[model samples]
Target: MTSLPPQEFTSVARAEAPLDENRGFACHVLIIGGGASGTLMALHLLNASPDMRVTVIEKSALLGCGIAYSTTDPGHLLNTRVHNMSAYPDRPEHFRDWLRQSGMAPGATDESFVGRQIYGRYLNDLIARERDLPEVSRLRCVKDECLRLEETPKAVIAHLGDGTCIRGDRAILATGHAVPVQSHAVLTSGWDFTPPADPGQPVVIIGTGLSMIDHLITLLRNGHRGTITCVSRRGLLPQVHTETKPLAISRGHVPLGAPVSAILHWMRGLAADAERQGGTWRDAVDGIRAHVSAIWRAWPEAERRRFLRHAASFWEVHRHRVPPDSARWLQEARDRGQLRILRGRFEEATMGEDGLIAVRIRTSGGERVLPAGRAVDCRGIRRDPAKDSAPVIQDLLARGQSRLDPLKLGIDTNEWAQVLLADGRPSRRLFAIGPCARGAAWEITAIPDIRVQCAELARHLHAIEAQDPVGVSRG
Candidate 1:
């Protein structure tokens, strides 16, 4: 694959030409959110179909970073290894190669983890190269939030917050992860608890997931010496990535249609077997990672739900391993007695007499009242249109343009990611990718997964565009 050139930001006035009276709509594709997933989809579509016109709408002023990569803090690092961070699976070493060529690193296979900001820069460069294509005469990017989406028999119309509408043959919703949930007590306090500046105050994190780890990193980097508490029902921190040698496990080790109890027994038996053979359970879990999706798919919905209710937390902790460096930092923080991880449930919260936020937590033992000078919730929020704050998603849900998944995981979609309607039919011109497609494919959030979806969606869109002779002719 060719490396993308540097991006040049120009105003819409300078880059876009006046729309011709005969040219009915704006572009062929109108991608919402110019983050990693959105830009990758655009790049794939343009490369696959050179004559296609693409336009990306980003609510933030910057593109390619979105919320995840928008952080300016040097402490925020990529959790995955550098080897698996490539945007393209075919070009397995693309990211490592880019890091070496861009002077971000000295070698391709260096074990050192790179900062998130550098990844943002690399994404921007990729977008720039796609924009510079010759066959792609129009690659307009608008800096406006989409407030509403109107689905017509012909095309999907996107209404911008600034009173502008753009129509496209197809729309791809790559709106990345939503903001972390904020505890009601913290919100009622009206306190500005931005990290680094207000590090003296004790804060309680809601979830002990990866997002919590990110917030913890920020708090530590900002020189906040105060006590930090992380609370969760399970209080399970992500597992640390190990460098143990690989071990092989056979496919038929566990039989299908086994009950949860039976499966747990089998897993335990396998662990004991491995240990007796001078191998650790980590090897078994690593082997399971290679076949997790298959296992997940094979299990019935009831079994999946049972796992979610019973063993999801523990499974997640083991599945989502943190980088070695991050694990070291977390370990040091714990050794220093600055960070506390508690397993409990949040009962209620109120403002204390000292003008701080007081939270009542119910743990396995009993109840305890804790006070924090300030608090920010790090429990990542789900993107459900019925419950999301975004006007666009709310409007779409209200107008029957989209439907929520039965489990409320995200928006409902068909296998191809075509947004499903309340009538249980797929929309021809509307599709969703990335986290929004969690309802269809449970494993659609990560970069590698989203990249593959983008390529597949691009191919599907290209086939549709080809079917419309008039649309192709106009373009």
Candidate 2:
């Protein structure tokens, strides 16, 4: 990735004023959700324009700590390496430098998997510096939830939970993940709470992904001597991260618009060749990370659905991996007979008289019943936007301002992050970034992907501003 140039400030300063009409400050860019994605969006925008007014709305008081970073557990290490996790693509070592300069990880190396807390603080400090840029545009951070959005011919109005409305020339939704759904006998394994209190009891964790790993770590660290059973269709845990020799594959090396089967075959041959050459298959996998977006876009809708139904889990397990320390801990737990990973479908679950949950799973051989003291639904968030319970997102769909993509993964968006309406037309005043745009960009959640997105989105918005300097009728 190319590095962005350092931000330059002009001698234009705007007075800090309230968002109401009395102050006469309409936001040039209104960002909903002040997480890593939103903060990056704001930073890129401010860096590009010294006179543009931007407003960021966050439910929490903090600027950059989202669910991923809000966890205080030191055991929750970043899955990605330090060098690739930088917020700025141009300054690749920005985060590593910050880690060393802030005395958090004084001798942090590029390959180090630092704690998520340290990265959260780095993001907070970065947002602070950009928000307080000298003689630049006003960057207001609002500690309130955005309830609904109303798109007008000239501007977009966001209604807040506090019964206040703020208007902006353009609005971008970066609301991140939705709350996961849980069955009657299963619990949502969020970081907000701990596991059940029974040391020698058995527990069933549905899905064996990153969240499941986090739940297991939390229970183990708390000295829970229970049997942890992780059940999924494939029961495939993420591969452990290892040193990689970068493959020689470029963006266009792999053919696009091919059938899903052909794509799989091509990838398999690449991986096999890498293995024969005494290199890890992970190198081939990482080689194509930059082209996933284009490949996904070119894929037919039917082919995309086929991939999701058959290969999504396999793709996820290999694409997202854990740190070396995490892998060792998991291996040790399994060896101690305290953990079990099973490949099966968790069928009907019943709550027993003694408060235990009896889950029936269908394996290859036969059906088996497991009596667990607790059951956690670690299937992660439902990706379909139509099924999301988020107030602002639901309101958007109800008002016909936006529609879910055909694949149901996320909201419909164009290549430039423009939100598409129910009539299959792009909204002139509304856009989406981050997970909300996952329907269009499949590999966008990671820091490396989002950093480039933020820079590109800022450039697109700047082009629009240049077209309409008076901030009217940007369409």
| Per-model TM-score versus the true fold | 0.86, 0.92
Each candidate: what lDDT?
0.70, 0.79
Candidate 2 lDDT, 294-371, residue by residue in tens: 889989899999988998788888888999988887899999999999999978778878878898899998999888
Cα-based RMSD of the predictions, in order?
A: 4.9, 5.3
- Model 1: how large is the Cα RMSD against the reference? 4.9
Off by over 4 Å in 2: 1-16, 21-27, 133-137, 469-475
In terms of lDDT, which candidate is strongest?
2
- Candidate 1: worst 10 consecutive residues by lDDT? 1-10
For candidate 2, the TM-score is 0.92
Once model 2 is optimally superposed onto the true structure by TM-score, how far is the C-alpha of residue 353 displaced, in angstroms? 0.9
